[model samples]
Target: MTDPNQSVLSKLPNNVIDEILIRLPFRDAVCTSILSKEWRKHWCRLPQLTLDSDFWKSKKDLTGDKRATSNFTMTIHNIITRHSGPLTKFTLCIQYWEIYPPIDNLLYFLSRNRIQHLVLKLPRQFKLPPSFFTCLHLRHLFLQNCLLLPPPDFKGFDRLIRLELHEVTISSKLLESLISNCLLLEQLVLRISDTLSDIIEINAPMLKSCDFTGDMTTICLKCVPRLTELSLRYYRKDWKEFDVANFLTSNFFESCPDHLEHLHLDYGVIAKGQEIPKKLPFDLLCVKHLCMCIYLDRDEILCPLSLIRSFPFLQYLEIQMEHNFKKNMPALECLEMEAFPDVIFEHLREVTLIEANASIREMQLIKLLLAMSPALVKMVISPHRFLGKSTIVKTLTKLAEFECAPKAEIFLKLV
Candidate 1:
């Protein structure tokens, strides 16, 4: 972003002063207008404006009173109207119902002057004005609690590189259309409502990272070969009918970049004695780091073990456990690897087992890990709570008996 007025502040002909003032809080920057006529002129030419609820809340009384809101709206109107030059970044997170008409007018005004980065967090699902989408130069857009009604002739924001939609009501078709047009898109974050019934399809070839909060099975990925990072906020349940084949055969992981590095999700998609298939639906041979959240039921380690087998080149693995199943379920007397005889962590280096109890089942896993992973370097076992010191000694003694491959160091964290 260039200085708004070259002749106004050309004394030193440097952007040092301009950046300092513009980067300040919007209220503090605006207050400079009261300093002098020259300062007021400088402010009117500000190229970027960011306003939120905190600006008006400074007044102690009647925070949301009608008169207070009126003054706030009028003040904003005056500031924007008086401002000159194109706005490169404009953010408004104020949740005032009275600002709908004012906001529409303001967006229309800014659109003509080339607003590139826009963020709007409304009080409710306010339908965006048509002028909002006409800002074609936008590179980044963040919208929350708004109804997205793209204009009929809407070609997407072609230059948009990043997009975030938090609880915004938008049709699945529009979302796909808008994403497909963003040829330069790299990151996408979505926190959509469950009411959006249609299956969401992602076809962005340039996309690299995605943070999503919804059912893992609902989204289908296509042609996204560059995606290297994926994080899901999933609340899992005892999925009786959810077959492992669904995930193994799903293109969600099949279309991932060859070097996919990070995977985070909470879904116990396997049982204690599930069958292992000959061929998987997806390839994870390039995965270097993997994190999984699983429910520990009846000392079932296969829930996580099955997924780890796919990452042939895995270097870092973290298993986050939850006691979502029967708490009193007895642990197996010893760990057994007869079921996974062909699986090995050849390139595995570090392993972290969080929220672990030193039950026979968990200890067996630790023993198996020590005997396997030849390249293992560090192992961290974080207990959910404190166990007596004797329990630690006994566990270590048991591990000492296991014939291991790598001389990996171990740490016990009582957290």
Candidate 2:
């Protein structure tokens, strides 16, 4: 029997249906419009527009030409014009095929609508449409592989909150202008070419999270008071040698709190093994939550243990070890332990270890847990890829048997 609620639910307004469809992939939602007359016109008015080549086909049945790129562009323009509302999002992804025409007209249309989120992925070079400078409401922007011909000016998006660039090239002046103009930006990610200096000029006063990825490493922070979270991944060398001291020497976190509540740094160091940086003068006295993904060889220095102890108020810690360390690696006994067991926090609550290779090598962690003054509320242990279930269970049983505080629980998974 059909439920009475089903009929009521079906009576809901078409606008609500359009809202739901906007969140789905552009191709799938657009095709649903053909199923019913009521659905056909609503899709054209969706605030979010996503165009991807994967949904298009070359066939005599659908269109005379399989590669009708012009038709696709025209269809997109019609959708925007019919929608008659400020667009919230516009994403265009073009992959593999190179038959596409210039996208300047599309960008201009999107900019004119003052889209809040925009993502464009293209293969070749293209100039930013003149209308791009007027997109003042844009909050999130992502551009990949679209080589900016003259390197468009950054003054375009004044309210951009988040920006991501991958495999793109930009001049330092443009980069500086972009950062300076997005004064309210909270998160920023940069992955670019090596020729471009690994530099970031952050003038955002309300900036909070920052991630600098790739081999390129130089970064300069000018005036960011509210900034807290920072992530540095795949750097060429230690970022400590940079002018962090100069940036903070006058006053560390003066505009923000004395302590950062969370920090993530996945970077390479000068040491051969998983060694911690030599007792650096810089201090993160207020960090409370930390997630670290660091790469270290079997015999490298063990820096994570010491690093955690430095955070006086640390309550939660998550560590993801590199996968390469688990294969044909040397014994853990061969490494140093001076900094290992002493790093457990006095107020620590949860500790999670991802991709741990050897159970024997994990004894150092067990020793650290046993030495903790505070009750470690929860612990997660994930064994290496090759570790057997029986071995992991036995190892966990042994570790769990060790003396622990009143509120401690251990979790283990073998992968």
Candidate 3:
């Protein structure tokens, strides 16, 4: 019997075979060299290489080799040296804890080859080589647990589009300088960096998406004229409190770009005595999609409602609910009376309630939104856990009885 797989693969063009090999892990793709002489020739031409730490660890476990770091370093050096084509993408993740692998040589080779996409996640903070910053052809760069110290005369990444830094130690001034230099940069993400304690300021005019998740006293969006999506997850540390309302009210958001559309705010963890902002500082009239992940406590609930009133153009709303069922729902009538008269979500078409148990308070809020949003089209209620069929039916019946929009549809989803 003839093997159809081999027959089909044999008929494939060399370029198609190279494409397939490029998508596979470096180790697996290299192993295909044993399949045939043609495959061996095609594999060497692959432009993408992903060297994951887990693969090296598994190899070490199988071979019982204590010098895994040395082996990994040598393997990567040999692979880079033997490659026949221009390297476009390279990812290296080192997991050996005993010693820091020599990455300067690898980065130098990649830089010389004009790599376009680069990702490095080292076990410890490895100082980046100056050659890395000079990779003019690089477009996407993601570094985790690395030290970045750009030279004083650092001419920025001219063609870089997306830059992500996680647990990287870079000063606010240096980061701003680096971003200011990237003329064509589009998206920027900073996540949980221990060194970022100062007031962070972003001034990218061409940027479209910005996301920050960490502890910062203040964040100022200096001038992101083209920003359409913004996500912020503030983590409170010690007794120092950060106020979201103040940030929104600042000149930064007050005169925020009109192009902004998507906004996501998550209050990850608040201190015992800390207080969540009661009201948004400025109206999000231009925003169309809004997501709020907050505790369903007295102060937190009012903020979302206030935000709903502020963003009159909001088309989609997603709320992640968190609260104690043992405690009674707070008096929301006062808030409703104060905010509901000004709130008419005429453009809101979809509402999503996540981690909901269909409790009385949640039902009330849903009903309130349904009544307010005259153009509501769909309401998706995703419960925290599965419920009995009878319970689901009852819940649906209750929802159907609510005075919703003329064409509103309700769906009960169990998770």
Across residues 292-393, which tens digit of lDDT does each residue of candidate 3 receive? Answer: 874665455665566566787899999998866645564556345345676688899999999876666677788888888999999999876644667667
Residues 1-415 of candidate 1 have per-residue lDDT tens digits of 5455644554533256568678887888878766544566666677778777656565421245566566656976887678887678888875554434346777887778788888987756788888888789889999988888987899999999999998888888888888889989999998864545677788888888888875566677776788888877643333444445456556667667785688876654454455544445555887788887756554445546666766788899888867642444565543466666787888999999898766666676787777668888988888766556787777777766766665688877765
Q: In candidate 3, what residue range of length 10 has the lowest lDDT sum?
A: 269-278
Give the lDDT of residue 81 in candidate 1. Answer: 70
- Residue 163 Cα positional deviation in candidate 2, in Å, after optimal superposition: 1.8
Taking the tens digit of each residue's C-alpha lDDT, what string does model 2 give over 1-415?
Answer: 7556555545769777877887777778877766555567666777888876545545421332344566666766776567676678988776444554556666677778878898877554544555556667889988877555332354446688898877666676677777787877888888754455646656777788877775423455677677777766554323432232233233323333553577775644333432344323355677777888634453433555444555667788888867464444444552334444444467888888888764445655555555573667888877777777787767767886677667887778645
Ranking by lDDT: 3, 1, 2
In terms of lDDT, the poorest run of 10 residues in model 1 is 234-243
Off by over 4 Å in 2: 1-11, 53-68, 124-127, 149-154, 193-195, 236-259, 269-276, 294-296, 325-344, 413-415
RMSD of each: 5.8, 5.2, 3.3
Rank list by TM-score: 3, 2, 1
**If both were scored by TM-score, which would come out higher, candidate 1 or candidate 2?**
2
lDDT of each candidate versus the true structure: 0.72, 0.64, 0.75
